[model samples]
Target: MTRMPFKKLALSTAAAGMIFGAALPASAAGYTDVPKESSHHDNIVRANELGIMTGYGDGTFKPNGQLSRGNVVKALGKYVVKHSGLTPEEYVKTYGTASVPNFSDVPNSWADQELVMYSKIVKDMGIFKGSNNRLMAGNLITRDQMAEVLARTFAFRDLPGAPEISDIGGSAYAKSIEILFENGISVANPYHPRATTSRAQLATFLVRSYDKVSKEESVMPASFYSELRKGKVSDAIVQIGSTLTELKKKAGDPEAEYDFEGGIRHVYGKYEYGVPHPVLEEGDPVTTVTYYFDEEPSLEEVMRHMGPVEQTEEEEDPMEYDYLWYHKGDFEVFFEYEWGGDTIDNVTVKSNR
Candidate 1:
């Protein structure tokens, strides 16, 4: 496994779209504290509307309040249920009530049944590990601890290696922290791990993680295009020869842009955003659409969605671009140079005829 290179891409500037469509109108479930101008207003509102989070009895969502470990766990429980295609009663029934108490602080009482159940689920999934049989449910969680919990909840442990973080190298949460960096959830700042995270910060993290998970799960398999392709590198939206303007209109704005020799390359993946058009040079359209990965995906993962490769070749040199090419009839996928060079960097679609 090679260490994946990090590329800085622009963030998407498009209007925040609904996660799974608005469960309820924001106006219908208004929170007094979260103003329309707040940075996390949309995320907090969406999470609340989806039943992942809730406001106080006074109809106030303390956007700047510190979230405790117990509260975080409860929120995650609701999140999983909403996205798991399972009803609340169904999940509780399937996982069963917590017969045995795992944490010293949270007892298996009728009043705490819901919390205990959620705690047990997270514990069984290895997302929340208590210390000395004590989860310190009421204790405020640090940023690093939050990273570990979120990473486990999303099952992001198999991420490709990331740059060394001096402070996190020896910690038990090192891998989880790395996954956070790899998935664009957090940055590698020295003091951030130990810092306390606010409700606003957690809201952003949840929304971003939700989008990432959704995108990965929603990717169309190559076989899906069997009838759509028509033996050409084209989808219902755009074809090989389609102009850059047409592509933008169909796919909305690209997340990132890269400058190439004759034209510009646009990326439509988890991270980055841009609206530049590709330069139209003579021979080919010169425009290339590349797909970036939040976590470096293996060749098998790519092939799973792209079908079998038609050809494979290596490009090794300093003068010329170094990359590995996997031809798939109508398009060629490129894996850029790294230590092992097995992770895909981008894909180029063109007319094979």
Candidate 2:
């Protein structure tokens, strides 16, 4: 599994599009306090609704506070359920500083469950560190530090073809930074993509990234769900047709047709790709595109292939292009292309998640 840099891309800079067409409104949904216009408003709301995050004591989620290691754990505890991997108590016993009793600073009360849970996630994630053997959970997390932690949490470490680096400066956490950008997890960079990140920004970023990771996998949104639920009979029919057309080619069955369920079409075909196409007895209901690797590519190959390219201002700039390299794998893909007459520079990749 390669972990590519996922957030270092250029901003597409399209005008504000409509809100997420399928999700409920933020204020009405009891998910977050930020306004919809804020880049992370929906993410905060969604994380709250899913029981993955909460606002600060002031009834606000300070979107710009510097994050602390303890705070990071507190936020992550919202989702670290007990499982075969490890239990919360076990994590605390294993990772808690020996000098501090398990309940020290954490009252041995039911309200302290969050602290305990956070301790476990931090431990399991290998992010708990302290000064002189004391787990300094209270330390403020720096920008690059947060990046390294995020990359590890998402299993972006040891990507199949990660680049060799002497150091990412003090910013070892640069790997996970992309998760923040691709999902619109944070907007610390309102006008620029590579701007420095703050702690409060990191908090919101974690909340949103965790929320998205918990959702269904590898399924693009199908417009048919909303159309069918709204009783737009004509629209539903059209979508169904379009979906069928899209899947027929992928599934490689000329005779394939589909039935709809659970907001997705259940299409059966002899194969999923590399098949013959047939004219639909009905009109073309769905159109689909398939992404084929031009070759049996590896991270090393991608890096080698792209190493000599330069950024073209006439084309997408470096920041906007960063995410493309990281989206495919854990290798934290970087672009060393020349930009604006500079001979060399690097950027992370961003994903739309």
Candidate 3:
């Protein structure tokens, strides 16, 4: 349990959740040095233990790989099943057929079941459309596309109260963005709507949602739960009040794109937990020497093993994962980890997606 040379600050700040990639356990940072024979040898091993995501082919978890739209969709689907549990049939019945157009890329036989399932959800939510009414299943998905899909899937219909002057404008996604804002689903840049999203950002958003939807007894920290049981309103509020406040501010924006009749809808997704490291900035010591541990450490006692911590600068410009550490300059480091047969690693360099 090595402590950093820097001051030991209690992680009680309102923005701590944002820094940690949405309440991720400290073990997600993985040790800077790993043993070759360790059971959790690859990156994302800790994330896998937390049941957030999985890895890919070749027995390696490409944690730092760029997250594609398909990957994002699949991950979202996994979360839905874990948290919301919408069966394929149920998903299709609720939001598919009508919204998804027939496409040559996605034939009835190819990914037929998955296509129907996702299309129904996207369609019913009115967040996604086929490229020319065709589901481009084979194409790599982008960050912007996922943002819209996530916004719609979350059921953010309109901004809260009256739309501010700035909130009222933007492309078709403006309204949806507003709704996302109001619901704490996203906090968009005041200046742009087409800004890119990052894997870390997505992770944080999903984690928050997990907290919102999970049973209070399930996700709430035991200490906090004890307080709540004793009706310690102040203590319980302290644990989550700031997060709730941030979400409240986000609600200011309205969902202008599609106006669903009944508020926002809740979709299923998994909660990925891991410590996020910032990408280094230009002129910073190239050998500052941080570690990315890829092992399944005991979450209860892992924070002590992070070694003497030396926090870096706040990202000048927010990327998708700005809430975590920002990738400075162009070069980024993505420590790979394998989890659930998928890769989940934080990128420290330029945007991977």
C-alpha lDDT of residue 245 in model 1: 68
Task: Give the higher-TM-score candidate: 1 or 2.
Answer: 1
Model 2 misplacement above 4 A: 1-33, 56-59, 82-121, 157-170, 176-200, 215-353
**Model 2 C-alpha lDDT versus the unseen true structure:** 0.37
lDDT head-to-head 2 vs 3, winner: 2
Using lDDT as the measure, which candidate wins?
A: 1
Candidate 3 regions off by >4 Å? 1-50, 54-64, 83-104, 111-127, 138-144, 157-168, 188-192, 215-353
Choose the strongest candidate by TM-score. Answer: 1
Mark the 10 consecutive residues where model 2 has the least summed lDDT: 7-16
Please state the error at residue 229 of candidate 2 in Å. 44
TM-score of each: 0.50, 0.38, 0.38
Residue by residue across 75-164, what tens digits does model 3's lDDT show? 554443323233555544532344445444555566456545554444332344566766665565544465456554443224336434
Q: After superposition, how far is residue 40 of candidate 1 from its true place, in Å?
A: 3.4
Q: Report how far off residue 158 is in candidate 3 (Å).
A: 3.7
